[model samples]
Target: MKESSLFRYAVVGLLFTMLAFSCDSEGVINPTPTPTPTPANERFLVVGDSGTILVSDDSGATFQAVTSGTTATLRGAAADADGHCVAVGAGGTVLYSADSGDTWHAGSCATTNTIDRVICYGSGKFVAVGEATGPDPYGIFRSTDGGQNWDRYAVTVTLRGIGARSDSQFVAVGNVSSLNDSALYLTYTTGASWTLYSAPSANFPAGAGWLYDAVGTSGGYFVAVGSDGSLYSADGGTWSAGGAVIGKLTAASWCASSSRLVAVGYGSGGGVSKGRIYYASSLGTTWTEVNPGTIKFLFDVADDGNGGLVAVGAAGEVLYSPPPADVHDAGSLWYDGVSGVANELYGVCHVP
Candidate 1:
């Protein structure tokens, strides 16, 4: 072949090789839309260590945290019948809000037990429970004046959380007491009395898991969650395993009817992605995940009363709000989509 022809072919081959390399070389594509997003017209509060709690009243659409001055790690929160909100956490942490998280004040943890969870029913009445530290440990405390003053009741074992089907009928759960040291604590007197109860363990491929959270619904149903996909059950008397049905039920709530249950937990083992909502009509059935998922860590979820669900969690996460037409039925913000947290969100509530 002629020298000129050979040079032309060489140039063409080099150009082709360069183009192929450019196409194959690892380079970032536009980042996939973060599954965690703020929904329009929804509200959210991001919880973190001593950081201002971020609040978004317009659904997960926008957010603002109180910056006056505070730096306590809030772990749990709940709303009252009038929509007032209360939060609790570290440093004997207890917080209250009259303007729906617009302003906050540290209440009191009653004991320095690392109060991890709290719930409010109404009439300035609230019950908060957490891990016990020293002697006379493991209990649920009551607050009558909107968390202003607390009365702590001592129990033998540690309780992770407390819930009530009514003011008189209450339930709390932790490790079930066994010769092996596993125990679960339950009460009927709104913590006026606590009894050691046994429930089915969240049986893992390896071993039984630890109980993390629990909620009691109207009628005669109660559900519990634990590590590595463990679930437990209590139907007034019997304590049985709810099974390893859901992936990670970090936070859950009873809604719709006594039969409808919604749970938000995550699967993204790395960080805060792959969050999902698992729904169950009944507690005994295995839970199934909701589709069209995003990288969201649905931590704590609640029924907003108008047919929609509100769940909050890590990474400033809130479930993006539903459509505008559904607003009335949806009721309030943070009703069903995952969101992003500047820090971490452990608790949220609507103080109405």
Candidate 2:
């Protein structure tokens, strides 16, 4: 071979040898790291009319339907930190999942009354509340064994929503026989006993409307929202009035990361019902509305476990807001999410 060609071949051979040594056994050089799979506990669970249950594992970007094992209208659901999820609905139906909502099984609530809301607290303790139904209906039910069994609690007033600040502290809000008057109940012994509190007439001077939902904050505060956009707050003792929104709020949730309370419901706009979202930063003392860009009636709202909020409502409407560093920002806007089913969605929860 010519001298020039001989030198070229030698250099090429040297380069190939160096490349071989640089690669691992898989023939990959400095391979990119594989992304960690999303944990099951980070999923969002949505329940609606006709036993509709939708789960989103991708931070509300997409969702898939899951069998709820019942055709009763599911009004509310909650998931514990341990991945246990329980859903409550019409006809006193209760469904549970031990796998973070991947699969569900029916559980006995011992009543046929419609369960409007469900909440899970420390150590698998679950509490549910709804309207009084049937001849022997109890408005509240407690389950300490991950919902395998339940104990009923009798209250004179119908309870619509329940919230817990700790395993021992809880508050339930609803109305008496008439929607014109509201009722508040408190339990400090893990629901062993409950006491009714006098209504704060100053907050609802005309008449206490139906209080639909209540949420407890990490800061030891409980806020409840209800008819005519009314809001009330309690500091573990005294109940006081908070600011009102423009429409009735069916559901409310506290976002610890942002220190904001978000509520969702429906309001009349241009003679048509439209979904409404409101946020309060001053511990529910005042609220400002944020446009969710939808006309469907929103029934429930919850943290998306990704520092954002997910709301579900009429006509299977699912709305999602991006994680706003400041949720109280007036410019914040919500976008639409696909829920697949057209059933009226009533409740949503995120298991972080």
Candidate 3:
């Protein structure tokens, strides 16, 4: 070969060798690191009229429907730490979801009465309460077989709400079917046997007091909310007033992360009342109200397991509060977004 050509080839070869050495043997160069995706922060199960059940993997930003296997109106839902959920509603309707509410199947309790609320606290153990239109109507129920079947309790009052501190202990509250009668309050210490509790006549006047929901707190306390106000119990039996006169509180939840309690309901204004929300750091203490600016008839509220909250109400309206702190400001949380269903959303629950 000519000297000039050979010199050029030698130079090209030297440049190629330098470039090859600069990179790894595998030929990868300055590769950008792939980012790890964030898993879903929270999962939520929401049930409403017409047997509607929706799941929101992204907090409450969006929702997808799950087959509920019934056309009855679903009123309340409950979940354990593992995300096993049970929902109840009209006509004694009971639905169970083993996979964090992703899918559901119908279950029977051999009653034609309406089940207003349900709570699952232990493995295959569930408690529900509601009213009935037929014989032996108003009372509570117990299910040891994971909602596959249930056994009705002896309490004859219209039980609106129920909660369990453990598998063996539970508290339920409600009102008499007759408006003139007193509220129906009771507690279960061990099993089938339930002891009745009478609220202070001064605090819960007859015909005016109606307890709707009760929840077990991580702090080892139970708080039952109602139209007259809130009641707190160290053990689920003896109760005292929580002194919250906000309005007709329908539901309350205990947020263990923040050690706070949140309650939701509607104001008792004359006609077409607006929704209301209250928060308390301690039971039997004064509760502060949260103003959402816009009015909605909120029926249920739950802790999001992220220090925030989720509430559902009329017209499938959902409200979500952010995590790690205060959301009292009108716009601090989000609302007014539609859930695609026109039916009223009666209950909401969050699964970690």
Models 1 onward score TM values of 0.73, 0.83, 0.79
The lDDT of each candidate is 0.58, 0.76, 0.72
- Top TM-score model: 2
Residues 71-190 of candidate 3: C-alpha lDDT, one tens digit per residue: 899998877766578899987788887788888888777777888888776766778888845475546777777677778776657788876667777877787666633354455544
**Model 1 lDDT tens row, 1-352:** 9999999999999986665432111121122233434344544454555644767665544556575145777788776765466677775677777666778776665576667778776667888877665664746777877776778877666666666666666666565434222345566665566666543433212343555677775456667665555444444445555645435667667664335566667665333346666656546356645531346566776554434455666666655434324433232223343334456777655434
lDDT of 2 by residue, 1-352 (tens): 9999999999999987776444322232321222322322347899988789999976565689988888899899988888788999888899988888989998877888888898988657798988885586588888887777789887778888888778888888898765477787888898878887645454343555778888887568888788856545555445566776666888888877667788888876545567878778636778777666677899988885445777888998987765754544421446677899888988899876
Off by over 4 Å in 1: 1-46, 67-69, 135-138, 176-182, 198-208, 228-236, 257-259, 268-273, 321-341
Those runs of model 2 whose alpha carbons end farther than 4 Å from true positions after fitting are 1-41, 198-206, 235-237, 269-272, 325-331
For each predicted model, how many residue pairs clash, with residues at least 3 apart or on different chains? 36, 0, 0
Please list the residue runs of candidate 3 whose C-alpha ends up more than 4 Å from where it truly belongs after superposition.
1-40, 132-134, 180-185, 188-191, 199-208, 268-272, 325-338
200: Cα error in model 2, Å: 7.0
Q: Residue 115 deviation, candidate 1, in Å?
A: 0.8
